[model samples]
Each structure stands twice: as structure tokens, then as C-alpha cells.
Target: MDASEINAITDWLIDGARSAPMPSQMMAQACERMVAAGLPLWRVGVFIRTLHPEIFGRNFIWRQGAPEVEVGTVDFEIQETPEFKRSPLSLVFNRGLEVRGNPDNLADVERFPFLLDLRQEGATDYVAMPLRFLDDTVHAMTLTTKQPGGFSDAQVAALRALTKPLTRITEIITLRRTATTLLDTYVGNRAGERIMGGQIRRGHTDTMQAVIWLSDLRGFTALSDRLPAETVVEILNHYFDCQVASIRAHGGEVLKFMGDGLLAVFPIDEYIGDANHVCARVLEAARESRCSVDALAFPIGEAIERFRFGVALHVGNILYGNIGGGNRLDFTCIGPAVNLAARLEKIAGRMGRTVVASEGFVRACGADWNELGEFPIAGFSTAQRVYGLADEAPVVMA
Candidate 1:
């Protein structure tokens, strides 16, 4: 490719490709543009590091004449694997080194076991370049060709020149993704979307009817007092995992993890379903959490001990939005409904029941429940009627 053609591709990266909706689409178009500019490109891959709880990074793969790019994620554990250690991507990611070789050559194939697979697929040239961001964080991009001889010296130089513009584009995409992932990880998904959509002002709350859920570990104080700090954290994580998985599976968003307690909600959306539907799902989540906690066992030296938790469910309107001091604000829900849920959770612990609910929740659920009688709540003036699952027998706590 000539100097003008390379410059055109660079311009496209800065202007056109930067606007692509996703990294996969950007990579596919970039590869197609490089091929159109007379570069012998059969396959292209771009690897970008990301900030996520589970995923370490993402890889976008583009093959010639393919309909769409193939995207995959790498976990943090991959860094410890022998395959990653021997791969060219590791060098590009860690040492910011450029790797160029003939995949068909025995020496190169021996050095990189993956090259042998490419050689079998008729790949001749392979080049991996480090895409150094402005912050000096190194990402990776690789180009492979099936052409007989491989990329020419001028073509390699052109590809290297394109990296500067490509790095900027990649950095933009990565930063956006990191921001989104971090928000979603810290706050719930719905809250994250609202914040991203510019609903960040304090006291900006929306009133919505939802099935409010509050749960707490029954003996967390005693357990934490006996166990090490790290052990307590591990146990808490395991306990929350059981509830979080079930809640999310049943269309609920966990908002906060306060010590040994958790707060979540199942919004009653007109488009999704009615109050009854949402209440039923919350009941399912509650039952699943109960069973999971019952089965959870922890070992303390010589013996294994089981743990339990209490959940309180109620259906009412809640204020969901940002609320806090000047600079640091918390995106969460608050109202009398949440307070009642908190009170009901304490009642569940006192009553030796695993799960308890308010009258509104039981009515919406339309399930067989045993009325646990009216009890005076701390904040409320009138006594509230609570109920428990009819089939769930009360456990004897030591």
C-alpha cells in the first residue's frame, strides 16, 4: 500500500472507525479497510484489557470474508497458564514487544505452539504489535496472512504506522467500557444505566412500586467475633453469592451489601408484568436463598458448622436514586417501605423463621402463608401483620 492509502486508513480510524458502536465492529471494519488498501491480511485480532470483576480482558477476532467479528473474554487465571506464557500476546501485553515471524517456519512454530495451528490453516506471516496507550498501558493487535511470502517490508511499516491512530481509538473504546463496567459492578444495572444517562444529581429520585427485599445473616456477629477477619469476609461472600444469584435470576437487583445484610428490589414494571408476577418471583428468590443458606457449611478446624439467614419481603413504593453528601453520593433506594423490610427482617430472626413477609407481599403473592400475628414496628405507629411460608417449619437456633 502507498503512503496516501495508509494515511487514509489512519484518517478513517480517527474519524469513521472511532464511531463504531462496539470494539468488535471497529476491529472488523479496520481489518476490511487494511485489506482494501492492498495489505495481505487474512486474519486480524485486537486484545484490550478491561476493568471488570470477572473478565481480565477481551479479544476481537476478524477473519477475511466473515460476516461478523468473533469476540471472546479472558479470565484473570489465564495469566498463570503455560499457553499464555508462551504466546506472543503475553509479550505484547507485558513487555510491550513487537513479534514478527513466519507461521510456516518450523523455528517460529516451535517457539509459539499456536503458530503451528495457523501454519496448518495456510498462514505464512504473523505479526503482533503492542498498542501503547497514552497512560503507557500496553494492549495487543495481531495480523496474519495466508499469502505465499508474507507481508512486505513496506506493508509491515505501514501496519506499524497505523498503530498510533489505532491506539487512540482503542483507548477511547476501552475507557468507555471500563466506566460502564465499573458502574455496573458497583451499583446495580438499572441504576448504572440511569447514572450513565445523566441521572446523577443528588435528591433526583423516582418513585416506583417494587417488592423490597432485605436479608441479614442470623449469627454473623458471633461468627465474625470467633473467626478471623479474612474468614469472616469469605463467609460473607459465600453467603451473599447464594442470595445474589437467585435474586438476579428472578429479575431483582441487589442494591447494597451492608456488613452482613443485603438490600434488593424487584421492580413491578408494566411492560414486564404486574405486582402479582413480581411478588411471585421474589418468593421464589426467597425460597432459593433459604435452601442455599441451609445447605451452606463452613469448617472451623475440627468440625463443620451450618449457617442461616433471615429475609423480609414487602411490596410498596420506594424512592430510587442518588442520595448522599456533597461529593460522595450513594445510588440506592430509601423510604418507609425499605424501613419496614428492615423491621420485618429483625422480626424473622426473633421468631426463628427463615423468611417473613408483610401483608401486602402475601396478598400479592397469593400463596399459602401462616399469619405470624400483628407486631408493633419501631418506626411505625400501628402494628403490622407479618406472615411466613406455610410449609416452612421454624428452626431451633442455639
Candidate 2:
């Protein structure tokens, strides 16, 4: 490609591609533009490291003639594998260096096993370059060519010239994605969306009806007193995982984890039909969590110790939004409904019940419930009715 063509592509990268909605789309368009400009591009790949709990990075692959780019995620565990260590992408990621391979060179093909496949596919040359972000972090991009004698020196130079513009665009996209992932990880998805949508000011709240979930690990104080700190933490993590996985799978979002206690909500939307379905889903989640907690066992010295927890579900209106002092704020929910759920959870521990629901929940869920009778709840003037799962027997604490 000539200097003019390269300049056009750089302009597109800065102006058009930078505003693309997704990284994958940007990559595909970039490659398409390069190929259209008479660059001998056969396949293009962009790899960018990101901040996430489970994902290490993401890769966007655009093969010539394909309608769309193939996007894939690399997990943290993959970095420890022998395959990743031996791959060219790893060298670019770890060493911050450019890698070049010729399909005709046996040593290059052997050193990078991926080259062998490229050679078989009629590829003649491959080049991987470092994409240095504003923070000096190194990412990578690879280009392959099937042209007769591979990319010319001029073509390679033009591609090199484009890296600076590409790096700026990629960093812009990566930073936005990182911000979103961090928010989603720290808060629930729905809350994260609200924060991103500018609902970040203190006292910014919206009243909404939801099925509230409050749970506490039974006998946690005594267990922590007996077990080592690390052991206690490990057990708490495993125990919370049991509930979190089930809750998320059943359309609930975990709002907070306080010591061995957890709070979550399943939002109710009038537009989405009746509250019965949402209540039923919360019940299913509670049942699954109960079974998981029952099967949970941890090794303590020579014997295994079983675990138990109490959950209280209530359906009512909650004030959902940000509330805190100064710059430090917490995006969560509050209301009388939350207070009642908390009280019901404490009552569950005293009653040795695994799961309990408020009268509102029991009525909405339409489930066969064992009426547990009215009991005086703290901070409330009247006694509140509670119900337990008809099929669940009171847990026998060891």
C-alpha cells in the first residue's frame, strides 16, 4: 500500500473505528479496510489484556472473506499452560517484542507450532507487533499474508506506521470495557448499568418492588472462634459460592456480602407480568442453595464439618440507589422490607429452619407453606407472619 492509502486507513482508525460499538467490529472493519487498500492481508488478530476476575484477555480474529470477526476470551489459567507459553502471542505479551515468522523457514514453523498450520494453509509470512498503550502496557496484533513473496518492505513499514493509531483506539475501547467489567464485578449488573448511566450522586435512589433475600451462615461466630482465620475465610467463600451461583442462575443479583451474611434481590417489573413467577424463581434459588449448603463439607483436622445457613425471602418495595457520605458511596437498597427480611433471617436461625418467607412472599409464590405463626419482629409494632417450606424439615445442628 502507498503512503496515501496508509494515511486513509489511519484516518479511518482514528475517526470511524474509534467510535465503533464493539472491539470485534472495529477489528473486522480495520482488516477489511487494509485488504481493500491493496495490503496483502490474509488474516488479522488483535489481542488485548483486560482486567477481569476470570478472563485474562480477549482476542479478535478476522480471516479474509469471513463475514464477521471471531471473538474469544483467554482465561487466566491458559497463561500457565505449555501451549500458551510456546505460542507467539505469549512472547509478544510477556516480552513486549515483535515476532516474525516465514512459512518456508522450518525453524520458524517448528518454534511456533501455529506457523505449521499457517504454512499448510498457504500462508507465506506472519508478523506480530507490540501495541503499547498510554500506560506503557503491551498488547499485540498479528497480520498474515498469502501474497507470493509475502508483504513487501514498504507494506510492512506502512503496517508499522498504523500501530500508533491502532494502539490509541484499542486503549480507548479496552479502558471502557475494563470500567464496565469492574463495575459489574463489584456491584450487580443492574446496579452497574445505573451507575454507568449517571446515577452516581449521593441520595440518588428509585423506589422499586423486589423479592428481597437475606441469609446468614448459622453458627458462624462459634465456627470462626474454633477454626483458624484462613480456614474460616475459605469456608465462608465456599458457602457464599453455593448461594451466589444459584441466585444468579435464577435471575437474582447479590447486592452485598457482610461478614457471613448475604443480601440479594430479584427485581419485579409490572411490565413483565405477575410477581408470582419471580417469587417462584426465588423459591427455586432458595431450595437449590439449601441443598448445596447441606452437601457442603469442609475438612477440619481429622474430621469433616458440615455447614448450614438460614435464608429469608420477602417481597416488597425497596429504595434502590446510591447512599453514603462524601465521595465514598454505596449503591444498594434500603426500606422497611429489607428490615423485615433481616428479622426473618434471624428468626430462621432460632427456629432451626433452613428457609423462611414473609406472608407476602408465601401468598405471591402460591407454594405449599407450613404456617410458622406470627412472631414479634424487632422495630415493628405488630407481629409478622412467617412461613417455611412445607417439604423442609428443621435442620438438626451438630
Candidate 3:
């Protein structure tokens, strides 16, 4: 690209970054502008590592005349895959290398196995540019050419010059996305928005009435001791699948995942539902989650056939917001109701029940709950009444 064309592209990208364009659109626009500037650009791709649990990274592909950029994702298992080990992206993403390949040279075969196939597909030269972020993390951008003579030294120099603004534009886009991901990953969506919306002062809280739910794996301590670490993690994830999906389906927001335990709440708002409606929502989720946990099938030789979980439901006024010390902070709920919900989980397991509801929940829900008799919770001075749900829940709980 010439000096004037480079300036124009940089201005366009910097302006686009301000408007919060998609990552793929930024890459595609850069490719379009570079080709307009007399650069023999055939394809461009970007590989950026992100902070998602399942997605290891994302890829943005820009071809000559595609309507929009074709996108793909790399799963967490990418490092162990043969496809990752064989590609030029692997060298850049793993070894932090800046790779250039010319298909005309047979010597490139040992270095890039993809060179042979790309050569047949009309690719003459390939260059991978490594972009370094302020955090010291390296990402890659691959640009390919179909020209006969490949890229001249001057053209490669110009391409290198453009990498700076290109990196800035991508980092701008990535930073926005990473913030949302980190918030969503560490905190619930509702709480994450409060944080991003500038409600970050310590002790910023909201008092509300909601149905609280707490679930715990029955034998996690013993299971962790008996199984390998990896096996234990997998089992925990499987168990969570049952709890999270059911809770979300019934309009419950998952608040936290405390080791083998899960905490969630169904907010009772005027527009969403009344107090009785909220209770029924938690009961339905409890029934579905219990069935889901029981249906988990393991291999014949596995330690256990299926996971056993105890779920407890309670309802009362609770304070939901940021709570912690100077160093560490957590956005969660805390109150006497929250403590009672946890205590009921232990009582459920001891009584051989998969689901248990406190008097507050059962009464507010107006559902027919079989009384499990009064039990003395550790912290409470007097005994409290606890109830369990039947196998089949009626159509209407209220």
C-alpha cells in the first residue's frame, strides 16, 4: 500500500473502532482497503485468544467477495487436536512465531503442511503477522497472496507498517468483548451490568424478596477423594448442566457456583410474577433438576451410576449485591433466608430426599408439600418445619 492509502485505511479503522464495529467487519474492511491500495491480497484471517470457558479462541476469515466474513471458533480441546498442530496458526499462537511461506519453494513443505493444499487452491505466498497486546499476549493475523511473483520486499514492508493500526483496532474491539465476558463469567449477568454501569462502590446493595435455591452434590467430598482431578471436574460440570439448565428455563438466575454447590434465585417482580408465581417457578425447576440429575448415566465400571444431589428452596427478604473485604469482592446474596436455604440442603440429604422446601417457600408457593417433620437447624435456636415435593408435581403449584 502507498503512504496515502495507508493513511486513509488507518483513519477509517480508527474511526470504525470508535463506532464499536464487529471484529470480523474490522478485518474485512482492512482487507478491502489494502486490496484497493494495490496490494495483492487474496485472504485474511485473525486468531485471538479470549476469556471464555469453552471457546479457546475465535477466527475471522475475509475472502475476496463473500457477503460477510465467515467466522469460526476454536474449542478448549484445540491444543490437543491434529488440525491445530499442523497449521501455521499453531506456530504463531503456540510458539509466538512470525511465519512466512512461499508455495513455489518445495522446501516449505516440512514447515507448513498446508502449503501444498493452499498452492493448489491458487495461493502463491502466505504471511502470518503477530500482534502484541499491552498485556504481553500475542495474537496472529494471516494475509495470503495469489500473485505470480509473490510479495515484493517493499510490499511486505508496507504490510508490516499497517500492522500497528490493525493491532490497535482489533485490541479496541477485543477489550470491549473481553470485559463483557469476564463480567458474565465471574458474576451473573444482572450483577455484571450493575458493575459495568458504574455501581462498583463497596456495600452497594438492593433489598428484595425472592425465592432462593441452593443445590449440592451428595457425595462430592468422597467422590473427589476417590476419583482423579480431571474426572472430578467433568463430573461436576455434568451435574451443573442439570441444575443450570432447569433453573434458567424457569426464569431463575444462577447466582454462584461454589465448588460442588449451586446457588440461584427467582426474583419476584410485579411485572414478572407474584410471590406465589415465583414459588411455583422454583418448585418446577427443583422437580426438573432432580429428574435431570437422576438421569445421568455413567460407564459400567465408574464409581457411581448417577449423581445424587440435594436441592433446597426458601423465600424471604434478602440483600443482593457486592459483599467482601478490601482485596477480594463478590456480588451475591446474603441474609438469614440464604443461610436457611443452605441448611435445608444438608437436611434433605440426611433425610434421603432429593428436594426439600422450607415452610416459607411451601407456604408462599401454596403447593401440596409432604411434611418431613420439624428439624433443628444448627444456627436456629428452635426447630423449623421442612417439606418435600412429591414425585409428580401438579399442573399448577399455586
Candidate 4:
């Protein structure tokens, strides 16, 4: 690109980044730019549903003003990668490489279905830009031209620069939306059979067996009141990041974050692995996460604040799935089990404990527990036996 063209493109990029629209809106703006620049079509997809990076990475094509590829559909496709061929965007998504040009000449595209679809749809020219942060490859951006040969070198370079900043904005938007989605689902009790993200078993009732996990930040509401909005957001986001990493690493699905708390579940059935193993792993992860939080308080040159968390786990049958009317639906868990989990969380707070599980859950865990005696939880009539997973360390709320 010449200096003038480079400057113009950079200006456009900064404007686009500054606008910071929703994903759908971002795609719309992207397509508008491509069309204005004389390209025929444009696409932006993130490969999240597919565990295997090689399949269709999160892919979307914006033609004209419509959102041809919606987020839900993209997530489904990612989760449903077949046993045979993986999606084409997998190359750029998993391998950290930018793919450009037509598949007939780009050997990698010769075997990809998404490319074939684009080709069928009259997208002859293509360019895929991989966004990499540090060593791990997060996602990719693909731009298309309907002309027979795909994008030109100049066009590809222009699109690449345009999308680099735009891609980070997209990632941030994705994470925020994902967090919001989980929160809505759990809070509304709409998450059903697919509670923990494994495939829905054919013929199985939409019902699911789950280990409901509720985690709350001690004094979060107060902290929010005392701290600046930006500071509050940063602290909660960092805390949530730690919790989410721990939950996913231990094979649990984080359902939501309600103000200062989190809801997660271990759908043993969906996990397909040993339920006990998964539970043990998640507990270990929780301890590690707590330790991580503690370590963060003293590491840097600046003084750091410490935070405490309360966690409660309950295993029972709960209704799960999408809930709501029209466009406001949520994917979340429902039923007495969810309520009981939350109640248990409250009990944990009263007892000044970090983690607690019911007697039934403790028995299922097959681990020795230090009993906290029968306690009358506010919402329940009978006193329930709660136990701390104190096989090693004592439980303290915070």
C-alpha cells in the first residue's frame, strides 16, 4: 500500500475500532467497507463450537446488509464437526497462518468445505487472516471477493490491516457476550438438557442430571459501591477470568455470573468422562484458582487487593435449555436444584466457609468431609447437613 492509501486505510481502521459495535453490527460495517472498496462479499467467523480447530473456524459471510451467518448457528456447526473432514478455517484458526486467494490455487483450500461453499456462492477470491496473541492462536478473519480469482495482494493487505484491530474488538465482544449469555441462562433457569455443553443425546428427555455450582464474591456489592465503575469491572472481569479458566480446565461449564457471584455446573452425563474424576478435578481447580487469586495480591510493583469466594455444589435433576419469548430467550438451568444450590451458597456465607456441598453430594464425591452440623437454610424447612471438603485445608468463607 502507498503512503496515502496506507494512511486512509489506517484512518478507516481507527474509526471502525472506535465505533465498537456488536458482532452483527461489526459484520455489517465490515461488509459495507468491503463493498465500498469494490469487493463483492465479506465474511467473519470464530471457530468456537468446533473443539477441533481444523474444521470450520467460526465462519460468517455478510452479503449486502443481512447477517447470513448468525452466532448460534456458527456455534452449533463448531460443536457438530463430523468424524471425516474438518472445517476449512481450521488451518488458519489452529495453525496460526493467514489464508488468501482461491482454493483451486491455494492447496489448503482444495479440501475445505467452507471454501467450497464460498466457491459455489460465487466467491472466487478469498483471504483468511489469523489473529494471534502471544503463542496461542485465538481466531481468524476471512474476507472474500466474488470475482473468479479471489482477493488481490493489495486488497488482502488492506483487509488484513483493517481487521487486525477489528479482530481484537471482536474477541472482547465475544467474551463479554459469552459471559452475559451464561449469566442470563442460569439466572432465568432456562438451561436444559444441554446444560454442560456435551451433545444432546437422541431421545433423551430435555431433563438433565447436574452438579450445580454457585460461587459468590464476598462483599462484591459493597466493593462495587466503593470502587469506580471501571475498576469494579476490571476486578470482576479478572476474577471471572480466573474462575472460568479453572472451570473449563476441570471440565465444567460456567453457566453465569450474577453481579458478584457465578453459577457453573458439571453435567456428568454430557461430560462422557468419569463424573467423580471431573468433580475432583474441578475442586482441585477451585483451590488452585483461590491460590492464584492470593498470589496476585502481592506480585506486582503496585499494591494489590485480595478477594474471597464462596462456593456451593449440589447434584440433582434440573430443567435446562433455552427459555424466553421471541428474541429474549436464555439457555440456563431451572428447578429446585438450582434454588437449593443458591441457598447452599447463602449458608456458606453464614458459616464463614469457602466451599460446602450437601451430604448427598459428599457421599457421591466419595471423599471424607468435615461436617458443619445440621443447619437451617432460610428457604428450606428442614435442617440440612452440610459438609466442607476439608480433607486437606480448612474451609473459610471469603
Candidate lDDT scores, in order, read 0.91, 0.91, 0.84, 0.65
lDDT of 3: 0.84
**Tens-digit lDDT track of model 3 for 1-398:** 57799788878776764543677767777888899998888988888888898899888989988888989988889888876787788888777788899887888866777788889989999999888887878899998899888988888888888888888878877888889878977787778888888877779999888889998988788878877898888888888998898888888889899999999988888565598987888888888887888899765364555777888899888899888899478899999889999999888877778888999888888877798899988888889899987653322211
Candidate 3, which ten residues in sequence have the lowest lDDT sum? Answer: 389-398
Candidate rank order under lDDT: 2, 1, 3, 4
Candidate 4 per-residue lDDT over residues 1-398, each given as its tens digit: 24464555456555654553566666666566556656555454544322322233344555554635465444335435651235545667557677655655556455564666666676677666776633354576666666556666666666667666666666666565555454434442234334345423432235778788898888788778877887888888777876777877777777777887888887776656466765677677767777766554522237567877788988888886666665565566788888888888888887777788887677677776798889876767888898886653554544
| Model 2 C-alpha lDDT per residue in residues 142-173, reported as the tens digit of each score | 99999998989988988998998999988988
Q: For every model shown, what is its TM-score relative to the native structure?
A: 0.97, 0.97, 0.80, 0.50
How big is the positional error of residue 93 in model 3, measured in Å on the Cα after superposition?
Answer: 2.5
Residue 44, model 3: Cα distance from true site in angstroms:
1.1
Higher lDDT: candidate 1 or 2? 2
Candidate 1, residue 196: Cα displacement in angstroms equals 1.2
> Worst ten-residue run, lDDT, model 4?
48-57
User: Model 1, range 234-319, lDDT digits (tens) per residue?
Assistant: 88988999899999999999899999999999999867659998899899999999889889998878999789899999999999
Residue 64 of model 3, lDDT score: 89
**On a 0 to 100 scale, what is the lDDT of residue 209 in model 3?**
86
In the order shown, the candidates' Cα RMSDs to the true structure are: 1.4, 1.3, 4.9, 15.5
Off by over 4 Å in 2: 16-19
